[model samples]
Target: MGTIVVTGGTGTLGRHVTERLREAGREVRVVSRHSAPYAVDLRDGRGLDAALAGAGTVVHCATTPSGGDERAARRLIDAAGRAGVAHLVYISIVGVDRVPFGYYRTKLAVEGLVERSGLGWTILRTTQFHDLVLRVLQGAARLPLLLPVPAGVPDQPVEVREVAAHLAELALGEPAGRVPDMGGPEVRTLEDLAEAYLRASGRRRRVVRVPLVGASYRAFRAGGHLARDRAVGTGTFEDHLRRHFAPGARG
Candidate 1:
């Protein structure tokens, strides 16, 4: 098998992709600022070339936090094209085109870069992850009696593992352009999701749904961040919560 270079291989989803590729007995090269099994900084052209050398595929799971610049995506795309990488797989969020949020905008920009890079590429767009849901709820739970929910919105959150698996499959195959969008099986409100999380965690708390007044809220309320008709995840919020909150369970 040819070398598979996975950017951001240490991240939440990247780790799973790296493991899956490794389990398939493919030589894996990881790219990041920090040193690991392999290391390269996307911002540095020379480092990127060194990382892409002899690699047939590049799975890009790298992302900047909200409000950060998106130049990284352009840089990675340029490097992939210049290095003659055969396949470039990118992980993107669902509904990026409809959502006006800064992060989604950056994601859309990255998708465009990959599309026009001239390298064979695949884009896997997935919904919010189960861990993201928990993080939102848990952070809100820290505050007393106030759980801030996205007002009047529906979300179909999926498991990160499912997204990771789909991404790995794409990385191993020929580029299929934009693959099927993935999401959790059930549609849910943020309020209900938060309440479910609290109940699952054995917390007796009243949920106060706050009307988030902003572009973010408007986009979410319009379901601009969800996948329609392509929900393919096997785990539900309840299942995820049960596994997360189970006694002595380490996920």
Candidate 2:
């Protein structure tokens, strides 16, 4: 294995991917706009060639959630192609093609770019993460009165560590275009996740189900973010809540 480059190496899942790659004794280089020594901005293409120069495989874990996911992906694809990287491994969300949500749409577009980029590539689609669900409810927990949540948006949240381990393995192997999707062991609604958070934290906030609006909600309701058949995760939502959020769990 040659030098392995990890984009967004400082971010949530990216951090785990980087750590796992390092743990596996791969020569790991992190690409990021700040902090990371390579300091490459995927959208801008600045420092990209230098960062990816000797990379045998480039693991793309970077995402611009506020927007620019497609653009950044395109930029990376172009740069990687130029750098002669052997394989491009991308971490994608499950149901990106089926979902009409903006982020998912962008992800689908990026997938197309990778397919046509004329480089060996592998895209690993995964379901939501446990931290994401907790973050949503944590934001709601700050509210004084009631905890507002989507009525029935179902989610299969997985552990970041598991997903990262999978990504690292993928990065080290031959490119397998659009690999099998991964998801959590348990499927739960947004409301259920929120209530669990509340209970774990010993908060008694009244639960309020608010009907979501727009095509995003429609896509969520269409089960666009689930991989029900592939429960690749070993941890449960309750296990995470109890370990990290439940009162005195650390003890």
Candidate 3:
């Protein structure tokens, strides 16, 4: 029932998490590069101590896909430890351990850091978010005549609001390390998702499947990133599309 700090509180998932926490009437501090009074960059530990001071829980949602997440997590752990924060909750991708992608590797490493940080910690791994899948499709749809997608790759895209609600629940409860993975209600192929996007956005493009070569691509094709058994999320990808393309839906 103390102040809770959310890193990257302005981001997609972080924003929802912050809203959920605030709805519960908990004191919430949003710490981010642009969050005034608590503008602390996670890349380094600068201004972190002040942000974490007297906070009971911290939801670590800040991550850099371009790299340097390990450094950021290390700095966060050290600061939380120094501030005597009770619980540290982290959001991670489901296949961090199975996928060989560089970003997944960094996420796995950050999970390890949280586990060994000697603090009350919890980690929730979920499948890809619907927004991320939409972004990929949108980028591919930008091509003149063809939308190229990874062949044989299936993604379970979960809703960010559901993940955020779960994270807020975890942040309020006692720390339970590495909880069960959360997945979307359905598993869909990239081609199918792309077609859906085209229909929703009213775009005309031929969807092409490209069998990309690489260990990471192979891992993705092999369903290493899926959580079929933990399909606890409620919203579907189509549901996301409707919301996304709705009139004045720009978030």
Candidate 4:
């Protein structure tokens, strides 16, 4: 295997993917605009070719949450094509095809690009991360009195480490077009997750279910972003929370 380049190697998910690849004894190179093994922005064509030098596979993990994900993805694909890279692995979110959100729209567009790029590719669509749920809980803590959750919406948050490991395995093998969708072991509601977190931390808080009124809400309530049949994570929300509050445990 030639050098495998991981774009966005410095990000939350990217870091885990990078570490997994390194542990497998693969020659891994991180591509980023900042302090990576190779300094290359996906949007910068000039730097991309240099970074792709001798790289047999490219894991396109870099993303822009705003709206430029498709443009960046296109640039990366073109560069990879020019450099004759063998495989391109893309990380995307579940229900990106059904969601009307801008970020998901961009991801869908990039998936289209990969399908037509003629290079071996694999797209892994995963559910929201456990960290995202924790972030929501932490942000709602400021309200002082209520834990607001979208009514009737369910989430199955996966561990970032599991997603990273799956990606690494894909990078090491022949491209398997659109691998099975991955999610946490259990299905849960937003309010229940929030309550679990509060209880684990010993914080007394009232949980409230607020009706979401938009396309995003509709999709979420319909479980559009979750993988019900293909759930594949080892850690549960409670397990993750216990580890988080372990050192600070007082009993």
Model 2 / residue 111 / CA error / Å: 0.6
> Candidates 1 and 3: which is better by TM-score?
3
So what's the TM-score on candidate 3? 0.99
lDDT of 2 by residue, 1-251 (tens): 67998999988899999999899888889888895568876777888888988789999999887888788888888888888899999988998888787788888889889989999999999998888888888888888979998887889999988999999999989999999999999888888888888888888898898897888888888787899999979988888887785465552
Q: How far is candidate 3 from the true structure (C-alpha RMSD, Å)?
A: 0.7
- Check candidate 4 and list the clashing pairs: none
lDDT of 2: 0.88
lDDT string for model 1 (1-251, tens) is: 57999888988899899999888888888887785545665655447877887888999987766533367777877777777789999999998998888788888988998898899999989999989889988988887767777668888999888888888888889989998889888889988998899889887667877777787779889888887688779899999899898889985
Clashing pairs in 2: none
Candidates by TM-score, descending order: 3, 2, 4, 1
Can you give the TM-score per candidate against the true fold? 0.93, 0.94, 0.99, 0.93
Best by TM-score, which number? 3
Task: Mark the regions of model 2 whose C-alpha exceeds 4 Å error after superposition.
Answer: 246-251
The backbone clash count of each candidate, in order, is 0, 0, 0, 0
34-148 per-residue lDDT for model 3 (tens digits): 8999999899778999999999999999988988889999999999999999999999999999999999999999999999999999999999999999998898888999999
Candidate whose lDDT is highest:
3
> Weakest 10 consecutive residues, lDDT, candidate 1?
37-46
Name the weakest run of 10 consecutive residues (lDDT summed) in model 4.
Answer: 35-44
